[model samples]
Target: MTMSISVNARAWMAAGLVLVMAQASISFAQNSKDPIPPKAPAYFPSVANQYVVRLNHEVPALRTSKAFSGIEDRLGASIKEVLRPDLVLIERRNKETRTSALVSLRKNREVAYADPNYIFQALKAPNDVDYSKLWGMSNVGAMVSTKRGLKGVDISAERAWERTTGSKNVIVAVIDTGIDFTIPDLAPNAWTNEKELGGVAGVDDDGNGYVDDIHGYDFVNNDGDPTDDQGHGSHCAGTIGARGDDGLGVAG
Candidate 1:
């Protein structure tokens, strides 16, 4: 049948056809025979392949408990260590398996909580031999002997050092018991009285009304030697300005 169509109608139909073709092209591209590549798996930080599981307080003798053993068997996990009566360390070879087991343990009614054994470390900490023991400077929840402090409860000295370690010109007086200026760590930063150092032993150099006060003055003993008498002053002085990054002792 012959039908008369207006020029505008013909143009509209052509435009509609183009739109349909575009949509079809997009769909084909989305589901192309070339195969849609599988998405890359997400990456996660590495762990110790272990998890710490804390059972309910009611759970007793977790090592021999039948219920706990059953859970371990079912999850294909093994007890690596028994940290406490209700706490255990579980190990799984595969990351996916560990994650799955952790989820299952969390859902168990007998389990109080479960968490992955995470690795912790300080960020750009000093190489001082005893830096780990200095909890006030950079607390990493470390245990010395049997004592441990709460993590992150520190003065952020490491971060502060990133800005400035401090200048020798800025003298900080340790008005405690007394300062032991002879120690290797504290000797470099110890404040010295140059006038007294150059003056005679019995004479008061720089006329400071003190005789031969080379390091400092001992007010208690009324002597020119400021050397520490009780050990407390030396302790305080070391904390204030011990030689840092020297690899000899703890950094100030």
Candidate 2:
């Protein structure tokens, strides 16, 4: 009887151990499938009807690059513009690194050319907060887009706010078309080179080659307004900085 009792006790203990390990494995598997979170606090500004593609480093420079020409031939759409990846301010891109090229495919062709070469890694966007209502000033534990209804469940912006909201000293130049400095929300935070605005009106006050650049210079029109006729510059400016805590539009 004693021997039987001892054997039964050992068997029960072994059975419990197995059950515990099985439960742990199931929990691990569920966690492993969790989505990767987004790194940026704001939505990646949308690139409309456009996809930026990169060539292998072995490819030549963009202007006369054979790879660029070949991609255009394959896509039936010419490269709209050559995009030079800016040398990272803190660390320059590798000398062997090649630049990215922009391409626009007809809506129908977008789906067809998405081959192994076209897509390197899957793109992920955050989707858990009520961004439209959030105003971007408040911390977003999980920001979800109301219009799109996609899901980026684990993104966090609380830690970034803890460190800094922003500083006025920093100048974020909108190098695209131009910014609408007159926009009420942005006007308060617009970057004016007071040094230039303070000087004589038509006389290249700051000697930066453009005259009277009180707000920002426009490369497209050769003017100072940067009023954003195409609306691209204004949209970009709003994303870069839109006056935090102003109770008007989105925050930077």
The model with the greatest TM-score is 1
Q: 86-150, model 1: which lDDT tens digit per residue?
A: 66667864557655766776787766666666443323565667767778877888886888878
Each prediction's TM-score against the native?
0.50, 0.42
Look at candidate 1 and tell me the lDDT of residue 69. Answer: 76
By summed lDDT, the worst window of 10 consecutive residues in model 2 runs over 1-10
Q: Give the least accurate 10-residue stretch of model 1, judged by summed lDDT.
A: 13-22
- Candidate 1, position 202, lDDT: 91
Residue by residue across 151-211, what tens digits does model 2's lDDT show?
Answer: 3332233333333445555566666656666676467767677777799877888888887
Clashes by residue pair, model 1: none
- Give the winner by lDDT: 1
TM-score of 2: 0.42
TM-score of 1: 0.50
